[model samples]
Target: MKPNVLLIMVDQMRADCLSILDHPVVDTPNLDQLARDGVLFENAYSATPSCVPARASVLTGMSQASTGRVGYQDKVPWNYEHTLAGEFTNADYHTQAIGKMHVYPTRNLTGFHNVVLHDGYMHYSRFKHNTKTIESQEYTDDYLNWLRGKTGQADLIDLGLDCNSSTVTRPWHLAEELHPTNWVTTESIDFLRRRDPTKPFFLNMSYVRPHPPFDPPQVFYDMYKDLELPDPSFGGWAETEDTSGEGMSPVTAKGLVPKMRLKRAQAAYYALITHIDHQIGRFLNAMQEFGVYHNTVILFASDHGELLGDHNLFRKSLPYEGSAKVPFILADPGNNLGLKENSRVDKAVEMRDIMPTLLDAADIGIPDTVDGKSVMPLCKDGEDMPWREYIHGEHAFGEKSFHYITDGKEKYIWFSQNGEEQFFDLENDPQEMTNLLKVVDYQERIEKRRNQLVKELEGREEGYSDGKSLIAGRTPKPTLRFVFE
Candidate 1:
């Protein structure tokens, strides 16, 4: 029988938050145990570093360039022919997505047999003008409808917190069992109980938390309310000024927040992560009770990382480690594929790799459209297997638009709006506190990485490169024309 696959995904969680990774403040005992049972990938990234495009890569098993979703534009149709769930469905698996599809039309199944979606306060979908259409959460979000049925509330944001704001935070107002995080687990457990027992399953249990509004359940919030949390890392290259009042805005993307306010946000953010972690534990226990825990292939990851005041940045879409890196843990508890247990791999992987990896675990054939390689070999003793030299990441963030190349030990970033550049020796400067572009010892290394970026962009329609040098001042678009074609 084919092994069941469980892909547990979270939103806006930092790469370093796992307690196993020595995160001083946050504790994720369940995830730490999950890592011990399988493999922990230390250098995983979201190439696009935003929700829409990053999730596109996860679902389609394609790079950002191939998906033509290099930024955070919503409402574009997910026109891909092959998806992770579609492939599993082709193999006769009972595929279900329980939470947070984040796709356009909101309910577009994207190949899942069914989707229980709650995209978590999408501004475009929740716009008063769009509420009459399918774009509204009222029409598409199962969790929202369910919440209303349970609490007589019209919306999840009844507490008046902006979904995207990092500065505002409070404990969850509803009953703990009614929270979105718990609802995702509760629904997932219910699926396991009622699912087709004759066929293997492919379940994507996604959560939207640790993202914003900074609200975890009240118990979780109090757990870290007074604990000393690590201060956000500040790079010398980051602007420290509060000019233009952007610093005081609740949803400011890049600005200096008052230290106390930032700390409260961090506390709430960590609380959400731990809450999700416990919910994951709850789901795993249910899997064990159902007698499928040992036979399952589990993969856990996040769409992207939140900056959370790192370098004075509050949200994602930047190429910094705090914004792009994500936690990736894959556990094959049954040893079905001969994977090494409790291992850590330093290979630089990304969201696109996930689909292929899970497919490989289930002995399914990968589709031709996939650009990512299966990490199964790396999980075993196949060190001799050829691997990617680096990962190329980019985002279209207007004035802050950037393309980056990193091999985990070093990173090179180039701003498209201007000819500005930043380089970091990631091994020595893990916090990215100093830019090393002008360092005499690293000029040659920086040049080689720059050429790699040029090669990657050679034939793109954006005219970002000339096959020899990167060109500046080109307008960066959220998607390429091919997506429409």
Candidate 2:
């Protein structure tokens, strides 16, 4: 029998936040069970932390900059030809996507042949609002008009935070009962129940909550309300002595995150992650009840990590481990046959490896255009292809941006547009408390990684630099500069 694929994606999830990862504060019994029953990577990093770029990387198996997508709120270029969606479709697999595709303008590939998307929840395109009476149409309207009946607020949504965050609110969380993962899972199970059954299917169950606004149900929030969140592990968000170019309020003095609210925010963030786990558990259980668990290959991961006060940052893309790393788990029950269960792999992996791995798992020929190497062997056994020597990720904002190449022990980052370089030794300073680019002892290592980074990105359009710019890459192409502006 052909294998089925279930790709479960959550937004803003961290690599170390899992119970299997031994995170003390967050509760993830289901995920822990998954880790025990499958293959979990202790170190996995995203190509980019922002929504669109990371999603694009996962879908296309290429760097975001190479895709020419540098910011959120951008669309796939008209010329991106090798997306995994098309490949799966070509493989004769019935492809479908539910929840936050996060791709832009709805016309976005839908990737799958079938799609039921959350227009408002993920990339709700309504223009920002002011006074008058405030407005929201995407999420709630989709829920009321198309999704739920007029009275469809029946279940899901209704987290402790104001329901105003939902589809109807200015920013819109919808109702706590309409919580994203729960809604996403519900749609996925419904699809599975109604599937044709004559063919294998590939489904993308994506969630955008637990990304921000940290809104969880009253009960979930209660679970972590009193738990004291660890303080910022890396001193704080310090700025260069000259703050003229980037002068902003220190993290502690932000809009609503003053002293009194930080505690609640932290708790809410943890609760939201637990909320994602709960819904994922429900979905996994449903697969078992339907008896498809053993036949399906389940891949669970997140677009990127969030900063619940880590390094005084909020969302993603800072080169900090907190926002750069994500959780990854792959389970193929029957194929495991006699393979060990409840095991883990400690090798370093990059999110870019996902596309190749998934297609390889499905027995689809990975197109030569894909820049990632398959890590499937690592799953079958811890030893694979000597593991990767280094992985690359980038975040580009206009002409200026940052790129990183890490050997797992040390990381070298270059802020290209500004010509600034940074080096951090994770093996020694886990929190990345200090920049060692100029440290006499680490200078050689820094130069080596820097050269490696340039070499890796060489002959690649977006990766071009003084040494490699003249060589042909993807294209000199137009910039989606409007999004960054």
TM-score of each: 0.99, 0.83
Error of 2 at 233 (Å): 1.5
Off by over 4 Å in 2: 76-79, 119-124, 128-176, 240-257, 335-340, 398-400, 457-464, 468-485
Q: Each prediction's Cα lDDT score? A: 0.92, 0.67
> Model 2 over residues 1-485: C-alpha lDDT tens digits?
57888888888777778876767789998888777767888778886777777877788887665566655544444356687778888888888888776665454654578777663333233433531222233432333344456345532233333321211111124555555556788888898899868888888887766765456777788888778776755432344243331213222211223444656666777787888889888888898898888888778888888665565445566677887888988777666433346677767776667889889888889987787777778877675447778777777644435778875677777766656777888888767788886679987888778778767666444546556432223222324443234
Q: Write the residue-wise lDDT of candidate 1 on 183-214 in tens digits.
A: 99999999998899999999999999888878
Clashes of each: 0, 20
Q: What overall lDDT, based on C-alpha atoms, would model 2 receive against the true structure?
A: 0.67
Winning candidate number (lDDT): 1
The collision pairs in model 1 are none
Tell me the lDDT of candidate 1: 0.92
